[model samples]
Target: MVSLDLRRLRFLREFEERGTLGAVATALGYSPSTVSQQLALLEKDVGARLFEKAGRGLRLNDAGHLLAQHARVLLSAAEAAEADLAALGGDIRGTVRAGGLQSAARRLLVPAVARMMAEHPRVRVEVFELELEQALPGLRLGAVDLVIGDEYDGHPRPRPAGLRFTAALEEPIKVVLPAAHPLAGAGRPVPIARLRSDIWTASAEGTGHHAMVVGTCRALGGYEPDLRHRSNDADVQLELVRVGAAVALMPPLALPADDPAIAVRDLAEAALRRRLVTVTRETPPAPALTAFLRAVTDQARNS
Candidate 1:
């Protein structure tokens, strides 16, 4: 008779997602030794070696992989049952963990949180500020209940299994320059080639924004930009442009609708735009998470 402890199974699932005892410990707020001990106990109960050494860390073996799959189903069932039981008591509330990019958090997620708090006081929501690389994995692994991610025009991201994506908003990716720049008041779509000599600021390397900026310049403008500053924060990029240090490529949500210090212009290429999407698990969402999703989409659409 196998009576697997749900808590131990949770540690296994976290290990599968995070890839190490130390990481699982950090995420679950437990010590590394404690995680190791619990996992060892799980092996004893299952009567099989679930983990094998991979360099300095541990990885799931065939047996471990099989059980981890079962663990996922069991955990999801447990969570659904818990939510249903809570609902029967006239309380439809559960903590929803959400992750998003910096701009999405500022523009959509924070407003949605406020709406959720005011309307459904009992449903708690936690926000994690993460980029697409970090947020999507967390959502697929059940660490986050919802994610707000961005997509560029040419570089589409692969959707992981058991996740659903819904487009929420689309905004043009505009060229931002100092108000004093010669092309600031050009009164037309700014010719990207004209700005080839100007220094540029954009999101850090390996991000979609970096690729978009570099690719757009090379493909359309016919010259590589003198990229001087790198930052993921929209405000930092805009500040550099506002102070005449560097120009930037930014979407409308990244800055104030109208700022006198900076001039926003459409690129000569009309197809340059950013798409924001909400990503979630394919499973049926609990009542609170459903409401939170509604709040996020409504805020995104109305904003």
Candidate 2:
């Protein structure tokens, strides 16, 4: 009878999902050499070649793919067993790792952590600020027990198998401008066509927010924006707007608490909004994670 190591099986599953040794290492918090060695050992144990060179990168061969399909079931069963044990323990006393985008972390996750600390003192919550690209992969690899993710209008993200998502909030995206700007006090939804001549600041290209801004502008104004600055930091974008350097499209949660120099207005032509969600694996979540999710949901609803 052959015995397979669950840890190495997990590594293979992560590699199959992530498609690279470096990504697997980052997701599992292991060195690249270690991931490679473990997978090699797994191949030795199974008496088959699992990986093959694909140009400069490595990809799983047919045998590896077949093994990985089985590995998913085994890993999920292992997780289910662990969850059962946690349920039997009857205490939310374990660590729950979570990740989210910047604005969500500040507005949603921080409050959730406070609630978790106060209500479930024994549970430890570890938080990481990660964009959707990194967060989703981390969630699939079991590095993150929960992820706060966003989906913009007209930019739906594909949901991978073995994960569950629950909607937290849906808030409009507003056009942020300098307080002294001419249209700052419009007191109504500002049309994007009116801002065509204005210099724009947006998230870096290829990001979901950036795509939404570009798409909304092109649809409403009939021309591409004069994008002068690009950044992922909402605070930096708001600062640029405050200094009269550029105008930006931003979600409400990204706004500073009391920035008198920034004015936010909804877009009349295209009302852009993003849906925030909490993501977890399909298996029964740990008690601490479930508690954290409840806290986050409550905070999001009240906010």
Candidate 3:
């Protein structure tokens, strides 16, 4: 009989998701040596060679990939069973691990958590500020129960397999200029092409924000933006604009309702927007999970 340990199976799945033993260890709060030892034990139990040396690191072989597929199913089943048992108790009391982008985490998630805690005193929510790239993986790997992500115009998020996505809010992506800039008080929609010579600040490369800024500029502005700064934080980007250092493009959720230091303007292009979404696994939700999700959705609606 093949006696498989669920913990070892989890380590295997984590390694598959993370693609590095060090990444698995860091994410799970274990040491690399411990992950290696458990995976070795799993291979021994299954009586198969699951890994092969690829340069200086280990890579999963065919058998390993097959086993990892099974591992995901088994882990999901176990989680469903846990949820079922928790439901039998008829109490909305459990920890809901949530992840979100920085702006949504502050604007929506914080108030949602407060409301959930007040209504369901036994429910505890832990929040992690994560970008869409990090949030999706964490949701698939069972690290987070819910994710609040933003999709920019023309940079649609990939459809998450085995997950449910719900649209929360859609807001315009506005341009920010220094108050002293010539177009700062321009009452009409500012043409992007008009700012070709201005230095700009955008989120870091590879993020949707960066991609959208570069793509929009090229397609609409007819010139590449002179990007002088890169940051994922909205406050930092706004500060750069406030100091007359650079102009920025950002969603309204990321902008303060009242900031006199910077001028916010609509882009000449129509329907340039960002859509905020809620993502979760397709598994049956527990009472706590349902309640927490409702709280978040309510906050989004109110915002």
Q: Which candidate number has the best TM-score?
A: 2
**What TM-score fits each model?**
0.86, 0.91, 0.91
- Sorted on lDDT, best first, the list reads 3, 2, 1
Better of 1 and 3 by TM-score: 3
lDDT of 3: 0.88
Q: Candidate 2: misplaced stretches above 4 Å?
A: 1-3, 18-34, 52-59
Best by lDDT: 3
Q: Per-residue CA lDDT of candidate 1, range 37-116, in tens?
A: 99999999988899999998889999999999999999778767866776677766889998888999998999999999
RMSD score of candidate 2 (Å): 2.2
Worst lDDT 10-window in candidate 1: 133-142
Candidate 2 lDDT, tens digit per residue, 153-218? 899988889999889999998988899988989567788999999999988887788888889889
Off by over 4 Å in 3: 1-3, 14-34, 44-48, 54-57
Evaluate model 2: give its lDDT: 0.88
Q: Sorted by TM-score, highest first, which candidate order results? A: 2, 3, 1
lDDT of each residue in 123-157, candidate 3, tens digit only: 98999888877667567767789999888878998
